[model samples]
Every structure is written in C-alpha cells, then in structure tokens.
Target: MQQAPTVLHVGWMSRAVDALVRSGAEVTCAVKPADAPAARTVCARTIVVPDPTRSTDVLAGLARAGLAADAFDAVCSGLEFCLLDAAAIAGDQAGVSRALAMRDKFVQKRGVRDAGVRTADCAVLDETGAAATALPSFPQVLKPLDGGGARNTFLVADERELTAALGQPEFTAGGGPWLLEEYIPGVEFQVDGFVEGGELRLMSISRYVQNLIEVHSGGLVAHIVLPPRTHPELYAKVRALAETAFKALGHHDGVFHLEVFQHAEDGEIVFGECGARVGGGRTDEVVERAFGVRLHDVWARLATGRPSGVTSSPGHADDKVFGGMNLSARPGPVRAVPSAGEVLDRPGVVYAEVSAGPGTVLPDTTEATNLRAGLAVVSGADEREVEDRMRRLADWFAAQVAQETSDTAG
Candidate 1:
C-alpha cells in the first residue's frame, strides 16, 4: 500500500491544520519544544523548533537543527511564521530556494519591483536613526521585516511619532530587524490563494476596516468583514495585482497571503506586505463562508500530493451571507467574566471565544479597534443581519459580565 502522503505544519495551531486534515493527509506539526503538547494535539508527528528567544542563541541554533531534505512532501506555516518557509525549502531545497525571500520585506519588494510589478516604496531600517535617512516620507509604516499577525506594526504620522515609535523597546531589533515605508493610504484588502505546479489559483478576497489608528495602522487589533459591500472594482484590481505578486515572489506552489491598499480615488493598488502561507485568525473560515470555497482544504490536499478537486470560484450570487467580526470589551482590570455558554447563546452570535479570564488585566488601548477582550464570529443572510447579531451579542456579553460582577459584590 502506498504510504499516506505526509504533510508538515509549523509553529502553533491554526484553522489551516484542520483544513489540511480534512483534505486527507497525515499531518505533522513543527513547534518549539515547549509547545509540543499543543502541536501534537493538532497533528500526528511533532518536530521541535530552534528556541530563538535568547539573544546569544537565536539564529545559530536554527541553522544547526534544520530539517532533513527528504522529510515531507510539503511544509507549511501559519500566522506570519517565516521559519516554515525556510523549513519547507530545506525539505525540498531545489524546489524552494527562493522561498525565504517572501518573508523579508525589503527583499520581497525589491524582487517584485525588479520583475516590473507595482509595489509601495519601502526600505529595511536596520537602525532606528537610519529610518529618517532611508525614507523621509512622513506618515510611514514601521514594522518588523519578518513579523506576522499585524503585531509590532506602526503608522507614524509625523517625524516625532516615527522617532517615538522607533524608540519603543518592541520596535527595536530582536535578533531579526524591521522595515519602514511610505504610508499607502487606501482601503485595505487581503488575497488568500495558493499555487499548484506554477498555476495561480485565487481563493478569497477580504476587506479590512480599522476602527482606530494606533502604532500599527494595519489593525494590530481589528475586524475582518468579508464580501466587501462597497468595493467591486477595487477588489478586481487587488486580485489581478495579487497574481502578479505571486509570480514575482517566485513561489510556484503553496498558499500565499498578500495585504494591499487600493487608493479609493485613484484606483491604484499598492502592495503593503505578504506571507508565504495561509492567513491566520480564522481567515479561511470567513472565506469559506462568503465564497463557499475552502482554502484550508485545498492547501491540505496539495501538501499530501492529493489533487485539489476544486473546480471553480465561489459563485458570486450565493444567497447565504457570511461575516466574521472580532471585538473585545473595554480594556481594564476585568472585574467580571461571563460563561462561554452565555456568550454563545446571545442572539445572532453563531460562535464566540473569550481569550481573557476574570481578573485578567487587559492591555491599554493603543489601538481602539483591537483592544479585544475576546472575539465573536457571526454570520447571517446579509450584512445588516451580521451587524445586528454582533451588536446584540456585544450587548448580551456586556450585561452578562455586569451581572457576574454584581453577583460577586452581593
């Protein structure tokens, strides 16, 4: 009997692993040794990663314990994790030599731009002082060159903010480095898709609406609402440009996530950044809802050499409306908490997950939108229905927490 095609996923559990499993592949997970339990729960095999937490041993250990060349058919990463890109290529050296370029902001843009693709002006700022020298544009974006999940990203409206942001301990290099670029003002959208044998297969398009601009304008904490109601032409532009970016990255197979800015007035689409894996935080879930296409399933099958039997794009007219929204209660010392059952029962709340427990000290609201005490994923027949459900769910959640606190007081 033929061996079950083996697939390897890297670093942390995500919706992508579930997608891959449903596609009929034996999955292995690669994670930091300490996180083995979580990784094993998600896959049959687990490979411990190089502990890069310390300054002295960061990249050196990774170089020492890299994967063998003949390990797995395909290797994948999630949540802006770049090590998977390195490991996948390490597993299949010749087939994936150019893979790591996708994770480095400067290299990725330079390569894409050299290939004649349209991209925002960007440069890697190795030193904080160099930021002012490398690109003098105010209202710039500062980010870790190899980071993921919208963390440590900042929008500097002026030189002072840029200076202050650069001064933050988080903004400084942590073994790796950061990037600064001209702030591309426009509506943001993400392209989630995959490449098979050099062919680009489009999956889904998501529009992002950020509630507040803090250090990271990229919704450090924000909501992803699918089936953007207002931008049809802009969506088309993003799709086309996304295809161009895929080719420019020299990526021949696997999932790709590209974030872009479409200037509402000029219709120009600027590439902000990209990753060489599936998007994180239930992105595929929302895509599956709005388009009736499962990106996770396709990604999984490809890892195991199973053909993605997907034949067409989600029919544009599907009547079922889907929306995924995430929000957190106002930040402070959480004086009270609600039971998960109660949050789930609120009208219009299809699914809800709270990350904080009572007495959890919620972080300060640097970004008005992503100060998430928790998140709720809801769907409906239309946007209004989703919004209404979200509002009711929010109200219900607030009331429940209040009651919990009141009861405790009594």
Candidate 2:
C-alpha cells in the first residue's frame, strides 16, 4: 500500500493549518515554542522552532533534532510566524538557502530595486549606528530588516523622534539591522493575489483609510476593499508592477502580498514592500468574499503539491461589492461588550468578530497589533452603502464598548 505524501508545515497560520489537514496530507506542524499548543490541535506532528529568522540556527537545530528534509514530500508556511523555518525545510539545503533570500525584507527590497522595480530609496542601518547616521529624509519609516505586521515599524518625523524610537525597548530587543525608507507620501494600497506557473492570478487591491504611521494620519487601522471606485485604472498598473515584483523576487508559485503607494500628487505607484506569503489579517477571507475563490485553498495545495480537490465553499459573483472594515474603541479598559450576533444585527453586516470583549484592556494604538478592536464583514448594494454601513458599525462598536468607566452600567 502506498503512503500519503508526508508534508512538513511551518508557521502559526491557523488558516493554512486547517486547510492542509483538510487536504489529506500527513502534516507535521512546526512553529515557535510559544505557538506549539495551537499547532497541537490540527497537526499530528509538531516541531518547536528556536530562532526562526536566522537560517543557520534553524538548519542546525532541525538537523540536530534528526528531522531530515527527505522525509517529507513538501514543506509549507503562510504567515510570518516561522515562515522561513518551513521554507528552509523544503527539498534540500539549497532550498533553505534560497528561502533566506525570499524571507529577508532587506534582500527583497534590494532585489526589486536592482531589477528597476521602482521601490522606495532605503538604507540598511544597525542598532548601534542607526542614531548617528543621517537619514535620507525627515518622516522616514523604520522597520525590522526581516519583520512583518509592523511589529517594530516606526515613523520618525525628525532626528529627535528617530533617537527615541531606536531606544524603545521593542527596537532594542528586536536584534536589528533595520530597514529605513523615505516615507512615501501617497495613498497606500495592499495588493493580494497568487502567482502560479509565473502568471499573476486573482489579483485584488485594498486601499487603507489612513496612513500606517499614526492614529490620526490614517494608519492600517481600517481599509476598504479592492479597486477603489475612483481609481479603476489603478488596477491594471498596480497588477503589472506586482507581477514584475513577484518575478524579480524569484517567486514562482505561492501567494504574495505587496504594499504600494500611489503618490498623492502625481498618482504614480511606488513599491513600499512585498512578502512571499498570503496577505495577513484575514485578507484571503476578504478576497474570497469579494471574488468567490479561496486563494488560501490554492496556496495550501501549492505548498503541499496536492491536487485541486478543494473542499472550501464557492465564491460569489465577481461584480458584487463587499467590504471588510475594521473597528475599535479608544485606549482604555473595556467595560461593556457587544456580541458578534449583536453586531451582525446591523444591515449589510454579513459577519463580525470582536477580539477584546468586556473587561479586556485594549492595547494602545501603537502598531496594527494593539489598534484593532473588531472587524465587520459587510456586503452592500454599492460602495456608498458599504461605506455607510461601515461607519455605522464603527460608531455602534464604540458605543457598545463603554471604554470610559471601569464598570458596565447594566
């Protein structure tokens, strides 16, 4: 009797884990020690990762643990959580070496710039010398050379701010060598899609309501669905740039997330960043709701080299407009809370999820991590209706969460 193809899965992407298990692969889940418990639920076999960002450490540890690469037919990951570790295990040592290039932010930024892909001008800076060196411009953004979800990402408005930011406990402990880029001044968009057999497939763009730098400047606290009604032509131009970027970065088959900026003045698109993984923050869900296809399913099959016998539900009409809007309350102790069922009572609200319930102290608006309170998945007859419903939902969520007092009135 033949055995099922053994697959080694990496990262804390629960969505990918569920998909892979459901896809019928002999899945061995590998993740950081902190994430092992969650991996235990779906994965029969789990490996604890030490330092995922460093390829040398990962390779040595895995070998010392006696987990040979040849034992598995494929290795896979999606989120930033231990993605490189999974990539390193695929096929052979050469595969591990190549995964470093794909996973490192500095390498990806440099690769695209070398290929004339029009990325922001950036310089690599070490923690020791970052403060002394003169930055390219004021209001520059600093991110970990190989980090994601804006964990240590900061916006420096001047020399004083840069110094303070670098001294922060987060940046100091992050072990950097960071990437600093001239903050691209423009309307930002997140393009999420798949590149299969060297072709860009099912590309969609999400526009942010605010800048990612701050609470007021319109950071990623909220975003609208793909193809802004005003900028239809942007779809073509952004897609082309994203395709060129994916190829230049040496990705053949996998999901890709590309953050880009359309200049506020001239409307020219500039590359902000790119990753060889599925779009974070349930973006694949938004994409599925919009187009009726599950990119996650495609990505899982691609990772495991399995046939396209997917069990995910079908998608809706491509023309139908759907919006995935995030909501939150002011920084304070959560007093009262609203149930998901209650939030869904609003018109056009198809689905909703609240992360912090009553009594949960919401994290401050630092990065994407602490800012979001809940998200509403709504479908409307048109963009205006979608926007209105989103606004209503936000207001309703704020009202629902009595952030001021320490106790609920009821």
RMSD of each: 4.5, 3.8
- In angstroms, give how far residue 305 of model 2 lies from its true place: 2.9
**Candidate 1: stretches off by over 4 Å:** 1-3, 47-71, 82-91, 94-96, 171-176, 211-232, 330-335, 359-372, 384-410
How many pairs collide in each candidate, listed in order?
4, 7
Query: How much does candidate 2 score in TM-score?
Result: 0.85
Please provide TM-scores, in order, for all candidate models, with all chains considered together: 0.79, 0.85
- What stretches of model 2 exceed 4 Å from their correct place? 1-3, 31-38, 47-67, 91-94, 127-135, 167-174, 215-220, 227-232, 306-319, 369-371, 403-405, 408-410
Q: What are the per-residue Cα lDDT tens digits for candidate 1 across 1-410?
A: 13466665655555667776666667766567777776677687666656423212323333455744355666555545444453544455553446556777888888878876777788777667677767856778887776544567777888889889877877554433678877777767667777777776664666554422432332333234455344577667776776777777777666777777777568688777777666655566666666666776776665456666677644433564554555455456676667666676766555667776777866644444435556766676766676667666665665555334355569
| lDDT, model 1, position 166 | 77
Clashes of 1: 4
- The alpha-carbon deviation from the true structure for residue 123 of candidate 1, after best TM-score superposition, in angstroms, is 1.5
